[model samples]
Target: MTRASYVRRTSEIEHYFDRTALAAWKRLTGDQPVSGIRATVRQGREAMRQTLAGWLPRDLTGWRILDAGCGSGVLSLELMARGADVVGIDLSAQMVSFARQRAAELQTQRSVPTAGRVDFRSGDMLDPRLGRFDAVVAMDVLIHYAPEDARSVLEQFAERTRRGLLFTLAPSSHLLRAMLMIGKVFPRSDRAPAIYPTDPEQLAGQLVAQQHMSGWRVGRSQRISVGFYTSQAVEVVRS
Candidate 1:
């Protein structure tokens, strides 16, 4: 897509969520943080759960968790439900507002601590002031950055996470590229996602040597469908 088209697409997405954020919380589940009302909520929730399973420890009772690019606070809300202390950040102000409202609503109705455990903030993915956490998560977020910037973002992720890190990205492969090109040409869907694609081999090389997080692994999560593959990766800090 052309630069102007990309900008327009991003703006359109932001505005869409800005209008629809609160409408999402009327139906709340433990999975609703990542499971906002889209044309496809079920698929989104499953994809988020699969991606988050990597950095989520079975016993994260008091562990501080960070949800980067926390859209509508779906995954952050889910983490709270599961007993982790969560801090979720998203680029969209409307999303942050919706997430906070959802938490309040859930807390009021459920009378549960799950709602109290989460904190949501508004910030850019590229901001430097974001703090550290025991585990950091960025589902379907990093792939938005250019491939050359992906390594830096990974390094920042490692730096911000004290124990572990998790994220998802679109695969850079000939087949996927061809598909993206064809999709853009025909306009099969207006909800075309911007992907910063990177080859798995290149990611492995960057993770192993450049960032020095050598034990990372990348694997596909439960596929919501054919086009949107949720992939998970984890890198344990050596310290």
Candidate 2:
């Protein structure tokens, strides 16, 4: 697809989630498991969470976090529980609404000592109006964008972060690329955004190893598997 069309389609993905927020929540938190595709998506969600959380700070007391693609507040909840003030952003109004609801539920259902000032906003991360934070987290979001767009997001997050930036991607590989191409045959009724695996090295170069960002270092997280896709994340730390 052309770059502009890809971006438009990527942004338009929120429409799919507006209709499938429940299913998206399943893929975000894996709180409930149904058979077939739902089960598989839940499994993937759990795996990704486990892998991503393993690399995060165990105690985020008083830290301010920006959850760039906070789908349904999955990671935002975790960060809040770890004692971080979190700002979660997503493109889908439904997803952001669900995330807000989940954040509220988290407060009432338990003593939310660490659930500090959690806020959910419906906006694209590429918006120039966004502000900086102690750390930024964008998990499994870049899979919907082309390489250029993915790189731009990385740079933008890096520029805004004060301490670190953590993110995951569906990494491109020879076999995986071919697999994605083949999967296009089975049409999906959900009309989800096309998943485009990105290159880890490209992300690292822009966010970590670039001369312009000379103070940053790279920390790779464990790979996460979701059957239809694979994820690899990195924590870009300011050295």
Best by TM-score: 2
- Encode model 1's per-residue lDDT on 5-113: one tens digit a residue: 4455456545545554435533432353443244254555555565566446666787788888787676777778778888888767867887798778878898455
RMSD of each: 5.6, 3.1
lDDT of each: 0.62, 0.74
**Candidate maximizing lDDT:** 2
Error of 1 at 201 (Å): 5.2
TM-score of each prediction: 0.70, 0.84
Ten-residue region with minimum lDDT total, candidate 1: 219-228
Instruction: Give the C-alpha miss distance for residue 28 in model 1, angstroms.
Output: 13
Candidate 2 local lDDT, 1-239, one digit each (tens): 35576467655677767675556564546465466766666677767776676667888888888888787887788878888888888887878887888777768888565546688899877665767788888887877776777766777777878888787777778876786677677566534666777777666776665667888888765666666546777677888
Model 2's TM-score against the true structure: 0.84
Give the lDDT of residue 71 in candidate 1: 71
